[model samples]
Target: MGLFGILIVASILTYIFRDRLFSRNLETKDDKYNAARKERMEEMDRLLDKINSRGIDSLTPGEKRRLDELSGKK
Candidate 1:
């Protein structure tokens, strides 16, 4: 109706939607994170399968390091 009324409504809407706006960014970040994690897990699984089929010594140095990294080992 008045300038003050419109200002109040806008402020309220901003406050109400603030979390949704911020969480949309977070959701995008989380989706990316989750997809990466899934990919890493799949890689780890494939590596483990290779180890299972061929034994650990069959792995190249890079594969070993990647396995260790995936395992969270040094």
Candidate 2:
């Protein structure tokens, strides 16, 4: 086939296989994102429990900053 025809066929095949080629990568990224989000939620819960039990004044600097960061997003 001519170069133009070959190029067109190659692009068409790439388009057809795009999902099969990339879906796994997309799912992996989604799983990682969900895991990180869940971890953050668990951390926030732990921090809240600490606050309830001991009050805010008992939080360390890092804990205070993390709480502030999470709270500000809300």
- In TM-score terms, which candidate is top? 1
Tens digits of lDDT, candidate 2, 1-74: 89999999989998999888667554677889999889989999999999999999989999999988877853
lDDT per residue as tens, model 1, 1-74: 99999999999999999988666544577889999999999999999999999999999999999999999997
The local distance difference test score of model 2 is 0.89
Instruction: List TM-scores for all candidates, in order.
Output: 0.62, 0.57
**Which pairs of residues collide in candidate 1?**
none
Number of the predicted model whose lDDT against the real structure is largest = 1
- lDDT per prediction? 0.93, 0.89
Over 4 Å off in model 1, which ranges? 1-27
